[model samples]
Target: MVTYLLDIMEYADSDQVIEVLGGAVSTRVIRHPNRSFAFEVTLDLEKGSEHFSTKPPLHFHANQDEFIQATEGKIGLELEGTEYILLPGQDEYCIESWANHRSYPLELERQEGRTVVKFLLSGAKSPEVYELNTLFFENWYKYQEHVVRKGGKIDLIQALSTFDAGGTYVSFPRWVPFGRQVSQLIGIVVGRWLGGLLGYQPFYREWSTDWQLACDKMESSIFQRRWAVRSKPD
Candidate 1:
């Protein structure tokens, strides 16, 4: 399959936005060509509100490095069990390959306003890394809806397992017996087959050319109200 990565240091004219965590926030793929660099932009819908109340599952890449730049508002990051708060204009935080990490907003108090961040993923496996996330966000809600129809909660394991074939492995708690091996097996055997049947494609075909149209659509969406309001200072 062909892949594309976005150019570093280039401004994105438009971006394909996808909602996550129930429309609380959205992520846009800024650039992804068929090379080593990839870029993404994230916007928080509710200023000052937590992007996600709970910590995300721990995961790491074996050959990709991530750099995060806070464009607006502050962000909190946890890298290798250490916490750091980053304010706008601060230096970018680097997460080297194989470093266990996660990030969220630092303050969840009042409507301090929204935050915007730019993330750059690069290195030997960057294209695959970007594709893995693209696949998940693109089909996450569909997977959830499917489970809801069956009177079952979202099957995160099954949904996330789709990335196993591409090397994006999820880290389970150490206490879960054979968790890693079992999950990998399920992702490879069950997730791959099921995802194919469900029509889940890993890469976005129009991201490079249709990004401007996507950006326009997202700006006019209901979520854009938050952006408008946040533009005015408190």
Candidate 2:
């Protein structure tokens, strides 16, 4: 969260390093079918984040659940329709499957003159779960970063493809009744079916560190991958 500038990155072992202006994300993913032993995210927020979103879009996972524990800064967790302020070691928090949620930074808590934010992710998985991997974190953030760095807004079709691949669904406006469920169905049609027909891919090699893993998972699904979707795109 704090700071860096330049589009360069380095990946070693399971940790993928993402550096941006005044921010850095080094992701480490430990995988398993029933649980993810570790998915650590460090958000350093000082300045220079004008192009990025302060919080993720309101979204829910169809089969994945997450736990959050902050060790450095305050995290504002918006869950369902309420926002909860989470402090370091405050308590163990869990975001269940299909729970609409997003996270944002709160006031700086340490003396680093910036928010020293660190988080650990543990997931609840099952045989029915389609996506237990945490590539969603890297893929989503990296895609947004890529778009912003190019001085453009996110492409909706591309976003839909990523969400579908990650087993996530966007939430609709609060005024609409059953908006989340409605939006979920719509996302499947627009982002999954229609988008697939157009050859928009859910995982992109330029944006995904674990591209093959993501591709393999998505390929096992109902939609057949076109050659473009199956191979690395230039």
Q: Which residue segments of model 1 deviate by more than 4 Å?
A: 1-8, 20-23, 32-40, 45-51, 110-137, 140-152, 173-234
* Candidate 2 local lDDT, 58-165, one digit each (tens): 888787687776666667789988998776646558899889898776655432465457665666664542564556666677777787678798889788877876
Minimal lDDT window, size 10, model 2: 2-11
Q: After superposing candidate 2, which stretches have Cα over 4 Å from the reference?
A: 1-14, 18-22, 30-34, 51-53, 107-114, 221-224, 227-234
Backbone clash total for model 1 is 10
lDDT of 1 at 115: 42
For each predicted model, how many residue pairs clash, with residues at least 3 apart or on different chains?
A: 10, 9
lDDT of prediction 1: 0.48
Q: What RMSD does each model have against the real structure? A: 12.2, 6.5
Model 1 lDDT, residue 67, Cα: 64
Best by lDDT: 2
